[model samples]
Target: MFTGIVEELGTVEAVEPLADGGRLTISGPVVTADARHGDSIAVNGVCLTVVEVGEGRFTVDVVSETLRRSSLKGVAPGEKVNLERAMALGDRLGGHIVQGHVDGTAVLRATEPDGLTRFEIPERLSRYLVEKGSITVDGVSLTVVEAGDREFSVALIPTTKQLTTLGVRQPGDEVNIEVDVLAKHLERLARPQLDGLARGE
Candidate 1:
């Protein structure tokens, strides 16, 4: 698991296509310092296992399923991505519980001068979002400022803008999104009661 806290901004060094997936080599000096084969690294919010490690770089295979579910499908050489290694057992959860599971992708709709950014998400995922709730965007944990039917906004501090991939996001770019796990748990637990109410029982 990851904490949605970006450890470094890595650059895509190469992308090699496979029959069923693709291999990506990324340059992240910090995250690759102690990395090894089979280690998991969160690359732009998608958990990818390390296949090989080299000087200041590591490679991971992206299966078709992961490619379809994340913005990584559009990644290319020269792209910058947020990178975070799996959290240690005793490490601080600086951000939140980020499973490195991208629920879906959201499109960048707008960005304000004051660091407020809005994203257009699928209507189906709107129920999981709420004002002040935590949301992981491209591997960075942020608090929602506003929530709407298909859009939500988050305020980014200067540190976020400077340290993560979010700082350079442009309008129309797609970002991997993971909503709060607690909200999903609550929904699942309440489903029976909600279903009974719907039946007027």
Candidate 2:
């Protein structure tokens, strides 16, 4: 339910380990201004629920599953993270539809600097990328300029360079990626029924 527009770069204040999960306290002025308990906030593309809130900071519990799926498991104090609150019912959809659910992580393979920067995509998420398709990297929505079997590329303009985390990422860093939901649904609908064919009985 996020627009994939990063409101601000938040910093992790603290991290506490639980038995099967962990609690994270992040400080973001813009997103925490009106925050309340149970509110949803997208932290680096992961939609996490606020368990507690105070001046410019909020707490969220990162369960074992989320940790396994995202780079948040490696997050530590002082790390800068992209932050966005859920889009309001009547708010403008500045970016494409973003669920704030990280499907998987992609490694930064390479970067090419032109008028618009192009990032060499990762193999795991390349199949979902296409020319002009929408992909969320580290919580920022971007369009693919070219795609290949192992790597794809996206054009990043100056504005995108200054506002989001993708601007400063290096090769080898991990980025959270959420493919277009419509593509996923279409793929599911088009999948052949192998089980039915195998069981002719």
Candidate 3:
């Protein structure tokens, strides 16, 4: 339900370890202004439910599975994270339809002076990308400029450079990535027919 639009750069205050998961406390003035228990917030592209909210701070739990999958695995006390609340019913979709569900992680390969950044993606994920397609990286939605077998590029304007975590990210850093849901859906829908065609049916 998120738009992949980062509302603010939240700071991780604490991380409490648990048997099955970890509790994260983060401070985000914009997102916590009207936060409530059970509210969903996108933290670095992962949709997490709010366990508590107060004094410009909020808490969320990340299970072991999420830790193993996304770049949020080793988030530290002072790490800056992208934060965005779930979109309201009537709000405009400033970005694409972002579920705040991280599919996997991509390593930042390079960034140009003009903010043209490229990430080295896995072939499994790259298959879903197309020129000008939408992709969410660390919770910020961006359009693909050059789609390759195992890499892609996106232009981040000055605004995005100053607002989101991507601005400060350097080459070699890892980031959570979510491919367009629509593309994944289409592939699934066509899989059966495509399989039949391969069989000469």
Q: For every model shown, what is its TM-score relative to the native structure?
A: 0.97, 0.91, 0.98
RMSD in Å for candidate 1, one decimal?
1.0
- Per-candidate Cα lDDT values, in order, are 0.94, 0.85, 0.95
Ranking by TM-score: 3, 1, 2
| Model 2 Cα shift for residue 27 (angstroms) | 0.5
> In model 1, which residue pairs have backbone atoms overlapping below 3 Å?
none
Comparing 1 and 3 by TM-score, which wins? 3
Q: Which has the higher TM-score value, candidate number 1 or candidate number 2?
A: 1
The candidate, 2 or 3, that scores higher on TM-score is 3
Q: For candidate 2, what's the RMSD?
A: 2.7
Model 3 TM-score (2 dp): 0.98
RMSD per model, one decimal = 1.0, 2.7, 0.9
TM-score of 1: 0.97
